[model samples]
Target chain A: MPNTLILSIDAMGGDHGPSVVIPAVDIAARQLGDVRFLLHGDQAQIEAELAKAPAARAASEIRHADKAIAMDEKPAQAMRRGKGSSVWNAVEAVKDGQAAAAVSAGNTGALMAISMLVLRMAEGIKRPAIVASWPTMNGISAVLDVGANVESDAEQLVEFAIMGAAFHHAVHGSTKPTVGLLNVGSEEQKGHEEVREAHALLRANSFDFDYRGFVEGNDIAKGTVDVIVTDGFTGNVALKTAEGLARFFGNELRATFKSGPLAMLGAVFASGALGAMRKRMDPGAVNGGPLLGLNGIVVKSHGGADAPGYAAAIRVAADLARSDFTAEIDRNIRRLGAVVSESAASPAEGAAE
Target chain B: MPNTLILSIDAMGGDHGPSVVIPAVDIAARQLGDVRFLLHGDQAQIEAELAKAPAARAASEIRHADKAIAMDEKPAQAMRRGKGSSVWNAVEAVKDGQAAAAVSAGNTGALMAISMLVLRMAEGIKRPAIVASWPTMNGISAVLDVGANVESDAEQLVEFAIMGAAFHHAVHGSTKPTVGLLNVGSEEQKGHEEVREAHALLRANSFDFDYRGFVEGNDIAKGTVDVIVTDGFTGNVALKTAEGLARFFGNELRATFKSGPLAMLGAVFASGALGAMRKRMDPGAVNGGPLLGLNGIVVKSHGGADAPGYAAAIRVAADLARSDFTAEIDRNIRRLGAVVSESAASPAEGAAE
Candidate 1:
């Protein structure tokens, strides 16, 4: 059936590596059928782990990659030297059309750098942006440019908005996702000169997505905006800060729940409720983030992700592949390109420009 | 006794205005001895609210102010037109030496703009920075430049480091607080050119404070560094994200604890534990943030603060006034200024420069 969704996963990536990735893959494959995984890493370690699970052994294939990219290595240097590294090899599988998508829980910088170099940008993408979704009070909100292209111009940010909107629609099933430009204030004249200009550009462009105007930092979790866009620097800081606070709150809740007999009894009785709360708050459910505006699929799982987290990433890759999201983005990009070209020739005419 | 630790509070500010501020002042007066509040606002409204509180009737003084600064108004325009506004009058009290410090839960932009215009920058200070603190897993970390200066140069960021360090030491009672430059990576060479240059400048200026090198987003909750410094844009986004996540988590917990009968039982037993958790996670505890490097003391409380939150702001202002934090900062600025001047004159002789 159109050659079962094949994912090339970096086995030696993340904090726990094969120990976590293997179990996660096994769980995902067991739950979701018609999925094949090409696990790339050292053969011996992977085989040793795979030997423990018959289901995993049957569902996955091993591809050897002798090298691993160090977390500290510079992205450019790592890409230059790591010809056979797990990250590079996994990306290569996508490039060679052997795999529909590539997943990595390794060094984010290396992954982004390799994806850009190997898969290259989609037809009209000036720069690919990293987009992630955060658990909000209502549901979830997607934020883009979280460490992709650290220094982006107005045009790059506009591209990020387009990609981010498409991602929300593809992944979250959002129809006409509201796009917002993140700024210090919601007022039109509030942010830096770049933000003001980007605001004008987003407004003038008559894209399929719903442009919701500017959004503030506090509005992120309020679920007021569907897709929030910003430069990589601000987006990165915002994402990490949300992550830090989530972890902090989790720790505090756990500590408080085990403080005394009353708390322990409460936790026991509220097990069902607590389980529901845990599921809602767990970062694992929202573990994978797609690198948008890329020609091929690349999903970066959390670096500290466990087996369950990795499993989620694999499912994400499969979903994107099944929906032909890349084809959709390509068509949209070509349409946008025509509009851009015409605008340049005409100087100022058409709402699309 | 010591002028009763007079605090000039903008009673006409914030979402709830004197309704919240008056009750907070009343509570603080009854709770903390020898604390006098000079409340500036519409005299009639202030008195009407003061009459509601038994303690406020005797403890607070109502100072008449004819206008109020709107939250969305331009900072410079607000300063020029709002001379008779409560926020302006509050700062005027500090300028006239009637109050030790000025506290406002009003428009942060307006507060900083007026504070800079009226109080001016400290002798060696090129720009004043807004510093905020939030509860982290490892206690608290102070983040500076939370929307003080939108665009920052290398020198401004370095000065932020020094100012943030002094703030942590004076307010948080830390001895030789460690200062870190907030970046995307912990590596020395990572981040923008400005961040890299700032890192070197911080390391070179031995006379300023203890420079703990670079820190990333995840390090914020780790409390590895006491004072984290960055530009206003990054810092503002980070602070707001953290605050938003905390609220999101708290709401999730509450919803889960009220799901069913079992959840209700758990909530009843865990009431004490839940209370403890709430206390720790309460935004009020970290209500007010000082606008550092200004000649006079100015504290900006959250705009959404309620009575208890306003009380926390008042207490913070009073404590800062008693500590003579401004004088400490001024003295350090002189030392830093001398070092900067000497290094400039010698060109290559200074050890750190």
Candidate 2:
């Protein structure tokens, strides 16, 4: 922790806890050199797992915690009684500047609540958004408000656009990431009030990011924009719907190959290509969702993710920690605040501004 | 018109127009026995196409219209000046009781606007919803408010539940379709005010449908319920997201098979099974979307759909017309009105009510 980047890990989080967390740290350590892990969990359990992974053991220091938050704990309950818990302490490390970012596989509600409480909102953000990397045909696009805020107004959606674009530029290294408001159609008159209002705001403002008006749901996979902005409810549904469909396609393909003798024989010859396709479609390849708008960085891994998947989350955390993500967000948010104030002064400026 | 079930065709509606519509009517004629077609469009063009399709020629009677609505025409503009248009007349046939339903391979906006204006709302519906058949692992499920009302209140969502369940029963023959309200999570406190309100309303009411608790996006493909009720915005996004993902999967699979000689050879061996799988995944197989809550039935086919797809739309309209769909909807809507009145009378009934 002398001069290296430190990442706080909730070792007792998720289903497998230290068993998966330790190995994940080992994997991430190889990829992310000069990074130290501040592990928060039961000392004996973590030490036992860390012993098996020499790479992780060399770069990790244990910060023992008395309790681990349950996966099914309500957000409010977790916030009220989760002090000194593994998840709480892991996020606390980030707040205390002992770690640049915190990575957790605990329940989303608990993690979001604890992270918000410990890290607090960035300068002007009312509600923090969870941004996920959406794998598209042309690489990955950033989709924000995945499940953080249930509903977002026009102002919040615009904030998401700014934050999402900054995150994309920081993590994915897009020079000038184009942002789009998710709507039913690209038409100006389409969609509901909030989306329409967001569209107006995005178009009116000369934000740092390129605003690409409105885009439909199909455009998410088409890679029409670098960042897709939407309310948490719609974004969450879109993300899960795509996941469900992908799984359905995989299940259907497997069942098709197993249906007949010819298909099975074909499967043998096509196994290499099919395996490549499976790899491309694998959720583990991009398993992290960064909780954006928080003062300190926090990356959340899927509860069911394997070591590689958890490592992916760790890498996302590392990317945000290394980049000027927080500063970029602050600059854009300040710009947004100015634009909003100007619009407020002038009634005829724009409907949403 | 004389004892035979009549379907009005918008001959000049879609991209292909009469070329697709005539053949579609011919194909539907063979399947839907004792059904007559009241064709509305350019009489000369429809006659030429109908001559090529003997089944359609025998069943259909041409009703010439001077104009056809442009595919890109705005809904308000279309409604203002589209009186004698083919789409207008096709819907008019339904209103006049000359046709059991109207099937159009037209622009959705124009169709929805024209249908609403001509047919008007049913006894109690404030806004009509567009219901689509979603292909699921367990047969097909009904998802509604696909793109009708972008912002639906709690009352509207409950209406979607009743209407969707009725439509599912009418067309798919589900005795009591299980209905689920689309939300971010299953928890009682999850999602926005509207979704939570809708969930409470659905849970409290004893509609004809079986009301399951709130469901997430993944449950859609898993076929957790027979019908999923959501606002047009979320439903539309979910539908298109799934479509985009499915298309992405298909494109990936095609690319995988074409990557190398061995993969191509494997594809050749697996062609039969793959073709079957392709059929299962085909959007054309489930092309039609019925605009529910209207006084008369109106089925809209995909604008780019071919003959088979248009035939599917016709079949949907026929199934809806032949059943007690309207009566069922009326009964359920009446019951809903009563329930709302009772809940309004009792202040402490439920949060949504």
Superposed Cα deviation of residue B148, candidate 2 (Å) = 1.0
Candidate 2 residue-wise lDDT, B1-353, digit = tens: 46689899899999999999999999999999899999999999999998899999989899999999998988888999889999999999999988899998879888999999999999899889999898888878999988887788888999999999989998888999999999888878677777777777777678888999898898888888999999998998888877777777778888999999999888988879987886686433488899999999999999988999899899999999999899988988888888788776322232210
lDDT of 2 by residue, A1-353 (tens): 46699999999888899999999999999999899999999999999998899999999999999999999998889999999999999999999989999999999989999999988998898888999898888788999888897788888999999889988998899989999999888877777777776777677778779998999888888889999999999998888877777777778888888988989888878979987786676433478889999989999999988999899999999989999888888888888888787776322232210
Identify the candidate with maximal TM-score.
2
At residue A47, what lDDT does model 2 achieve? 92
lDDT of each: 0.79, 0.87
**What is the TM-score of chain A, computed separately for every candidate?**
0.89, 0.95
Candidate 2's C-alpha runs over 4 A off are A282-285, A345-353, B282-285, B345-353
Candidate 2 CAPRI assessment class: medium
- Per residue, candidate 1 scores C-alpha lDDT tens digits across A1-353 of 38688889999889888888888888888977898889999999999889886677888999999998886677778879978999899999999999999999988888888898899988878888888877677677788888875567666777887888777777878877888888877777666767766677677667767888888787788788778898887888777766666666667768877899999889888877776676666433487899888889999998888788788888878878777576666665665666555554322222110
